[model samples]
Target: MTDTSEMDRRAELSEFLRNRRARLKPEQAGIQPFGGRRRVPGLRREELAYLAGMSVDYYIRLEQGKVRNVSEPILEALTRALSLSEDERAYLRNLVKPSHRRPVSRPKVLPGLLRLLDMAEGVPAYVVGHRADVLAWNGLASAVFTDFAALSPRDRNWARMIFLNRSVQAVFADWTSKGRDTVAYLRVQAASHPGDAELAALVGELSVKSDHFRTWWAAHHVRDHARGRKRFIHPLVGEMTLDFECLRPADGGDQTLVVYTAEAGAASERALRLLANWGADAATGAEAGEPEVGRL
Candidate 1:
């Protein structure tokens, strides 16, 4: 089964090229008024190839999965011709980087570290790792995110929440792009830590269970999710666009601390205050791993 590595590579090459082609259009590239009966949105194979100053045959071969190895110069030409976004361009380069997919190992979080999640005051905070495991979160985070506390340790997958959770699906205003980024980020994580068995299992589950994840993963996209504006439609709080920052400790390349905050005086701020009050008033039950007030 794994012997189909070459096929996989070729399929990725074919798929990305097709997607890029489908995304571009004839009129945008300044083609004259010969626009009747066009079957696609973006530039066609030969047309795009011609615009990139490459032979139509060569581009056709790439698109048809006939070309195995592509040079950097030609790749750059294709990148520009396709008008790739920063993320798309980076993903393109990563796919060509000769390496196998690996999983990042999950780290052991000391109790103190997990407790830090609860110290963010008004801001929502949570800790995740390379595999998108929910390492830890404070009450505000639990309030901001869907019932994260309810998920089994093994079932806590950010990607899964994005797709499976109806609440999470409604969270991102631009759900499609957010969904794509989640998949792409997983691809990058899978690549960097191929040895992580847990990550492998996660990918396996997603690839088999979700056709949408399967489609995106096969495209071989990669992304570095450092910071961004996240729109969350919390069940308790209507819609909140929060500025999120990912903090990686000096000793922590794999572990990421994601904190969320709203612009001062925004409706999101009011929603978060309401969430915090709900969280404070809501009895905090002791989880399996964490220490308790009486026990130790």
Candidate 2:
């Protein structure tokens, strides 16, 4: 690699560390405040270094982008000190030791995958790509959430909807937490695909348009969007709580199949059935060339 490129990488690593450190409060790290008022928002450099079992000078050098040879043990200590999540730790490792492979093109949702999604009769399922673009979704997913077919291809993005669409905002029971987690998950993707123009543009747009996104992006929180419980405020069926799982193919493309399901005997399950039936009716009406009903 060129010296200039190396310097750029180091600069990014420095900025990431500084941002992570700034988000953590002194008390959160179990540090007692001294006599003077803190000019900085989070723990001081010395305190962080102490907690990481490193010298202040060494930590400063690391933060200054002067040290390139970081050991695993030191990285582990820093991870613990900053209270980094599993995804954050992996991102840190990537920053320190970036992959040499060429940038990957966006993965396409295969026909087989679409068939599988269609087979999920009562479940709401969608495939999300690297930039959280809703590549493909089942009719039940459209019924449960906003209809992706109605939106333009460029707007078929989870991050975009979470921030820009009022309908999406209304659907989430806890919009604040959902927004934060979405941004954090995007951060993880950004780290992995640093050269993706679409991802960069999306982040820039969201940062400019939404204060909530800007604040969460600056916090440097990272999370794996694997499994979680989500509460949705559906206009047709009222409120429903569902468990979601993210599945990846063995071939290892930058795509995940996300499925949301409610407990078998729960009210949420009944609501889901109602939603599926509604979707089927809508499809039938569309096939019969009936006027489309406006989204609720």
Candidate 3:
């Protein structure tokens, strides 16, 4: 609303466009490099404009944040020229045409959702808010991963745990891949809710705390957290591979219900059973006021 805020938004838009353009190589945009040595790392402004079927001056104005009335066709052309992913394309559109509505408050898991999570027997299920904060989790999920109940509310963020928690790092077979994907997913959320102070704080904290996160964030990669195969090396069970699906509630808040399941009669299934048993024991211990020792 203020002049300073408007300037900040435009500056952010400029930086995002520059970063995306810098990541696109000339060859990737079907452009042949000249004989002279180039100073830039990626496609030059003119090269990108040529690939997008637009004039160099027009593209320059768009990148400079001087053109606020960008058309859909032009945005689509830019998306294609930059080889943007679905999430990245959505983010770009949001930057050009931001919603007038304010950012929503942090979402809470509903009672029905908690009941459903509890009823999801033999499956590990958890609810994560827009910022990837673990709002709620079933006992099976706690056993399969880290115990969310043991963690403080502020420390329950998936992004923070992935970077700072050794137990979480140990569980993931490919930590780097998972970390990059997580950061990219968060980047999409940040673009959608640019005014969310909590999200901004999380990003700032992560950037200061983890070099890996800082580098990945600068890359501006974006991904939808829908479905994927996750491999884990459990401390109790040797190794397990699980299929995970992310579900959004019909109520349409920023909460996602993620469920992980193992294939029937497979080794992962047996390992899941072991995890369930251990989880049950852990729950019993908690009921008896014993310290939770199942955390790994």
Best by TM-score: 3
Alpha-carbon runs more than 4 Å astray in model 1: 31-41, 64-69, 108-119, 167-181, 187-226, 231-239, 248-254, 280-296
Candidate 1: residue pairs that collide: 24-42, 25-42, 102-193, 102-194, 103-193, 103-194, 104-193
Q: Give the alpha-carbon lDDT of every model.
A: 0.71, 0.80, 0.80
Indicate the residue-level lDDT of 286 in model 2: 20
Tell me how far the alpha carbon of residue 49 in candidate 3 is from the true structure, in angstroms, after superposition. 1.4
Per-prediction RMSD in angstroms?
5.1, 5.0, 4.2
Model 1 scores a TM of 0.71
Better of 2 and 3 by TM-score: 3
The lowest-lDDT stretch of 10 consecutive residues in candidate 2 is 282-291
Given candidate 3, what's the lDDT at residue 206? 93
TM-scores of the candidates are 0.71, 0.84, 0.88
Q: How does model 2 score by TM-score?
A: 0.84
Tell me which residue pairs clash in candidate 3: none
Give a tens-digit lDDT track for model 1, residues 1-296: 43444555456667777887787776777665244677776787778877789998888887877765678888789888888767667556645554554433445654554565545678877778778877766667766766666777666678888767767677677787887888988876654553556776788888888888888877656677789897877767788989988877776356777889999999999999998887764322223464222110
Where does candidate 2 stray beyond 4 Å?
A: 1-12, 23-38, 100-106, 110-112, 281-296
